[model samples]
Target: MTHAATANLPFKVHDIRVEGLQRLPVEKVYAALPIQAGDSIDHDQVADAVKRLFATGNFEDVQLGRDGDDLVVIVSERPTIAKIDISGNKSIDEDNLRKGLKQAGLVEGEVYQRSTLQAIAGELQRQYVSQGRYGADIQTKSVALPRNRVELKIEIYEGKAARIRDINIVGNTLFDDDTLLKDFELKPSHFWSFIKGDDKYSREKLSGDLERLRSYYLDRGYINFSIESTQVSVTPDRKNVFITINVAEGEQYTVNDVKLAGDLVVDENQLRPLLVIKKGQVFSQQLVTYTSDLIKRRLGNEGYTFAEVHGVEQDTGSDNNTVDVTFYVDPGNKVYVRRINFTGNAKTDDEVLRRELRQFEQAPANTSLIDLSRQRLQRLGYFSTVDADTPRVPNSDDLVDVDYKVEEQPSGSIGANVGYSDSSGFIFGANVTQNNWRGTGNRVSFALSRSDVRDSYSFSHYNPYYTLDGVSRGFSLFYSKIDFDQTSVASYAADRLGGSVTFGYPISEYSRLSFGATYEKTDITTGDYVAYDIYQFLDEYGDKFNEYKGNISLQTSTLNRGVLPDRGWSSTLGLEVAVPGSDYGFYKLNWSGQKYFPLTRRWTVRTRGEVGYGDGYGQDKSLPFFENYYSGGIGSVRGYESRSLGPRSPGMIYVDNGTVDPSPDPVGGNLLTEASLELIFPTPFAPDSRSVRTFLFADAGNVFQTEFNDAADNVSWNEMRTSVGVGLTWLTAIGPLSFDLAKPLNDQPGDDTEVFQFSLGQVF
Candidate 1:
């Protein structure tokens, strides 16, 4: 009945009756009704009640009637969602689809609205389009269940992404089309398009490409260059896209004058060196912006944390295509850090994180110091990510609080493995390591390993902040049973037990000095074919000996990263000497260094050098043969067998048979030298991966006997072996895997050469 016809009718309800209610509770229906039983209701009131019930969205139909002065309410409840299933989804994960459905109010147990299904389909199509899948199709279907519920099945057809067929650039006179197109990430399909995937048409990538195109011209003095228009079209089958970029190549401009204006909190002479822009140079947007950042940072280093720098250009009235540029600097009030807070470090103690901060509370808020603090925390390997923020306190312009947010990562490893390596032969090992043991900023490690040539067990512990002044203290206990007879280089075996107490003091931000005292006892044994030098040493020094050694080392590093450094250098100097009263008195000197220079945005050049010399002193006659150095393997020269690059041992003779058998094992030497140069490259397959490094390297090194044997000559430069190789290292979930293919350039007749070498679970 019409509301107008029922407006004049007034009725007093005796009771309320509900019908056609399937899932909705009767109490909920009563709550929605404006006129209940025992309340005098008019037709206007009944109309309002019906309208309110429909607004709840819980019913598809609501009907109101009166019989014998009793109000009757009938409702057809909306179906509850039973389940949601997604199919044919490839690029987008199923979980993401379910999350989108939930966000769209289509989750299970919620009321099902038919309009929502259509909206979800549209949204799904939009997502596919964003990924260049213009041919994607989505369809949704609902199946009714027994309990007034429905199940939604979303079917998705993710077609192939549209490939870029061609890109046309118009109105380009200053630079060639090839040069301009090189700036764009999107490209026309070429022979390598399938592998690179840059031929795919994506809006996000297109936007970035356009920005690069603008930056390319802007950096070159084309101050007025502008992109007139950009047009993108799709093929009929939706399999290909064509892009067209139109531009205006404006007149090149030159700088007439460069000046500094506004607040000069620092000496102008000091700030002038920071400006990259100069008079008579081409107008460079990049240089201007870089100069601005430099000025801001210079002020920031001086405690002006809120400094603002801007560059303004003024066109000259003369028609010489010249402009005058001015840099405006505003050095706000000097900011002080009132408090330093650590957050999101649930497992780690606050003190552990606080100790890493270079910027302290109640000190000047230095930007570089704060940045260095974050970098130090990240280098600790305890957290996956670290972020720092300095926000001013309310009503205090000069007082700011620094906050450090850290995301804890797994810092402990308990691993056991049975494997084989080219250098180690068959191996089995188990190790437990905790870099942040119990969140106390201490390191503890225990390991036991057995190989065909070596067996060892060791335990070590280190505290980085032993005394809170950045001093490190550690100790190690180790015992090794070495069977050199099973190895390719040695014809002897030894059982050794050793312990060391080590201390490290940080001399500066990038330098450390370390001192270590070690006590070791070695019991030597000769095999059936022992080298003559080994037999002679055993005869002179006996089969067992005790030695006490002390070492002092100094190291400095400015590397940007630990795993894969793009730029920086590190140098180390070490001296090791046996105690005066030891069985043998000797001193060893070593110097090593490595440097990395960034060649481009994605490539680097690295060089490494090492030199070592050792000799007897005081009462000793000769340096111990067991302490000699051998150079080879992946750690040294890649194309060579481990420890096989030294002087040969004199042949051994047996008296039992009137014939002598020669031992072909290598005799390690007291002098060692090595150098390497590498050109590091990026991996194409994993462009965004930081743990994978590929490089091409040339290496030269050798071990030379100085006084081990009378027949062996002194070290010679011509005796240095050389190799060239290409290598790749990948850090997988299990461990780092390294692979190398090398070719020896200058190989001696007795030298052992290997073209291919690989190792697992090892750092190179």
Candidate 2:
């Protein structure tokens, strides 16, 4: 072709026009144009604008030309996403994949970016590979449709999971293979031994197990223990993987001597007692840590806010089996609290939080004070989280400001429940309560319940901190109607309306004493042939049937160590006394105590016991049925139903005949005592989450009349109602769920004990 010789002539653009603009406004095109009406166009600017337009991923092609002093911009828009299809994902369902892609900003009707599509494909492949599908293939295809949209299809071919062929452990002579294997969840099955069963493997879980093993050895004084190497290999066929762990088990050492070093604020003699380690003893990291904690705690109590104790070991040249330990104390600058701050209390008042703080501003910042402040806040139950940190002042190591952040949670709830029991069938109840009423550390509740045997409604309020120094006060009003088939006394039905006010005084942080009085009016309907003695007493005391009762109780609780409790103990003792001369005149006392001790790192032993007694006076010589103690079930004996283990009535009374004593002899109404021992084990599944606990328990208890002569005697093996069972306790969102499968060691005639019992909420 011959070229025209017009290179020197002026190049002119005819016009500038825009096409294929739907969502793109006409004004946008004009704004992007480089050449205005009557202006010469530059080829570089036109090329740049065209590149910018195509970079938006909104157009497939762009053409720029000139028509007489105007630039012509023509574009072909890329197709929008119309449909998405996914297939061949069994391990990961299609819906989940779609959701994942959607979260990554992919959806129909949006402009499709090639980079984003490629990223999605890569992510999908990675997920499949993680699931052990090494040979899996993923391909994505797009089809253009009408209306400038496209459809996408993702096809996957996922093969079987990669199996584990062998797991080999080297350089361990202390424990056998079985013991080490138990720590690992991976195992080889008979059919797939070559591939190690193709089990689903979790790298995180394996890492955790290795850490556990390390800690297990370190805690036993193997301080130099180390993992040499870890290797995982896959077979040529990609069907199985082999794991190998090489470890270096250093020599076990014993403590030769323990000495203190550095600037010690406390006397050496005083500090030596706190060190739990002893000479010639098996060196234990736990003991060393315990001693460090003890020193820290003592220093904290003395207002040494910034104190640290580090246990250092000096190796002796004796076969590498012995070491002398020294505790080096670094007493940093004594920190003083410049300020205390609280945050995240939108609903609660600032004063409510300030009053609970044990550590005050302008005071020495001590660890114990901060811990006590945190506990005080926790006891209010207002906040779900309370964290304290000492943010040091800039350029001043001695000055620090404490920040106490609290996260307030919902303190009110409306709950309804329906329950059934052999004694009280079809029980239904509901309640509305606010534990932190108006953020004042008070409780208010309204409850209504109805059952086949009883019906009641009650309103109550309590101020946990009624006084500035920590006294509590409470008041309750209730109306109840009870129908009883009293075989021991008489067949009668009574309705009562009552109210009571109580005041509780905290003798100390661990103990409290409470006094309360109630006024109740009871209307008893008797048969024509009622018992002569009861009829005479009631008739003589007519209109004076209104009864008044008063009670005084003392309760105490203590925990030597509150967190990570292993050696210390917690106990509670309660004694309640009812005054004489009241309508139901009797003196009742209830006492309970619990203790926990750790025998080893993995073993914990706990013991608990409870006793209840009542003595009658005046017209009534015994406790009322409502006031009697009933034992059995998870909280009590764990082998029987509530209130069903004592003297029970045989049948209902006949009004016309005034027939009493339903059974040949009643066996359900009596004072009770119980004792139990438990061994608790921490679960390995979720160590940090204290949601579940496993326990093996042995329980023994019995119920008897107040006048029973042998009440204080030690229960013999034959006399004791013993039960052995394993319990699973789950700290659920609602409350703790205790499920136990118990078998009674000794069974009496006509006993209908259940083989399994599942209960919700704490027994205490």
Candidate 3:
């Protein structure tokens, strides 16, 4: 039976006496009371106050009653946290588990809630499951302690990591098992017999492995391959598991004919290069998707609103698994941008956003303009996040409005750091910058640092739009003093002051070309330094060993906005040459290439390679000290110290008495050529975050004297040192942080190869 509150009826209220609160202030509870002493109480108000108190999730129960025209309230308060105990966590240390739980708002000596304890248990299970422990279990219990408090005990049963005992694949007749198995990291056995067997496995890894197999076939023209079923069986001992993957491998197909259908504003020939599938080529679904995206981008650049491309695949029924591919173009209703809306900006002005937008109101919404606008916003650094969406207008199919949503973030930051290492020893540095720079397209930065090896001060500014025509210009000035502590063959101390000014022009929607010139005066102090033979020869030609130098470089980059890409490649080429009118004269050329291929949704393979060469001009035969590439450092060779490789020279060898040795010896000169290769592995942890990624990399490279021009001839396999290690990289809130633990695969006698390297920025 339900009773309704009557306004005319009055209920006797008792003196309001609240109980069972420790941390909560008593005054707060009293102030929330709806009934007072010596007055008639309304049942509805009393009930509402009790409901509010219970809804706080702070009390186990609440009771209210009227006593002699006064109100009384009682609450069984939930206990406050006193202590937390964690047990049975061996793989992840107890401290780490506690910290992870604490991040989720579970901490000792704090208020306790049943829901919070349940949440902690769930998070713990997820952490263990992600590490391949599928059979793990966590249970939480609360025990009352003295003084109205409670202690929590988190019990964990982390079973052994699942192991793969056997793996079988069916319907893979086109390729053998050996070729397909190589793509997976989970294997039945490790390469080395003495090492532990490859037994770590999980259902998640099995799914990823199956996806890899499917994508491999799809990328190679088997567009219809699919995994029908995947099954796993566990052994009675609970130590091993067997997996079976049943796949459906359809016929291999090739493109016999290619055609374009639907409305086209541009000629078909203009769009041909963007197609991935051509006549007489293999028919790959990945290629079709990439072709579609490419056409969309091209049309968007041309101011086509709502442009879309669809791939129409037809079976040719030919003997060689051939098919005809037709790309149906739908340059849907060309709509103009009626308005550009900005949101989530409270401090910044509307003009600030408008200045960065490439697509203006009333103009045709094109892909190029939107992309440029996004880049400009990112460069401003005023917003931590920015996104754009085009919501269609109701009852107007041909019209849409663009919305640029931004999450404003602090535009100014300062950082200070201190650390020590064997290579650089003790170091301290600080940087201050204002990314917004008064809402203009400019940035100002100042940095200062002092280390065992170098001291420097720098100031720089960047203008994203330097000219009314949308050119980018930037300038920077810096002064530095570097001291090489003779850990390597060629070492010297130098003081330098330099600055560079650059101007960039957009060659196309995807390309930019820049030309810049730099001037620097390097005062080299060769007190006890032994000059290389090349330096001596240059000295004979009346070239000062220490002097001023300048150089001009032409740089170009073709970048595709690969926010989402099927397959993409980026390449950079630079050319710089210095003549003898300055202190140094050298001709240098550098080339770098990178390719990213999404083998599947869960895995990607990225490869990068670089090569640089220099030739002496006039009296100079090699690069100057500042321009030369120093190997064997954190940024270069990971396992050794900076400038510690190559040939050795001797001059003024200081004995214990600090006197120079009269006899001198010869050493190697700058390396004429160098190359390196890195294989990157993206981790599942923090996958969506782009600023940082974890990878397992193998690096091999060396620097040598010009006389050893042919690496194969003069370099031994032992000299070709290789370092394999794991690294943690952060696309940091400020910039980047990179740390690596590298070990030389082949260590030579008397080589001082350190096992770790730490750097603050990108390697490239």
Global Cα lDDT for candidate 3: 0.67
- Candidates' C-alpha lDDT: 0.85, 0.70, 0.67
Write down the TM-score of every candidate.
0.82, 0.66, 0.55
Between candidates 1 and 3, name the one with more favorable lDDT.
1
* Top candidate by lDDT: 1
Residue 617, candidate 1: how far off, in angstroms?
4.1
- lDDT value, residue 331 of candidate 1: 96
Instruction: Give the Å shift of residue 340 in candidate 3.
Output: 2.7
Q: Model 1 over residues 588-642: C-alpha lDDT tens digits? A: 9999999998888888899999999888997676678888889988868989998
Model 3, 466-552: lDDT tens per residue? 876668888889898766662232334457688878787777644567777777666654433444432344344432333333333
Consecutive 10-residue window with the lowest summed lDDT within model 2: 1-10
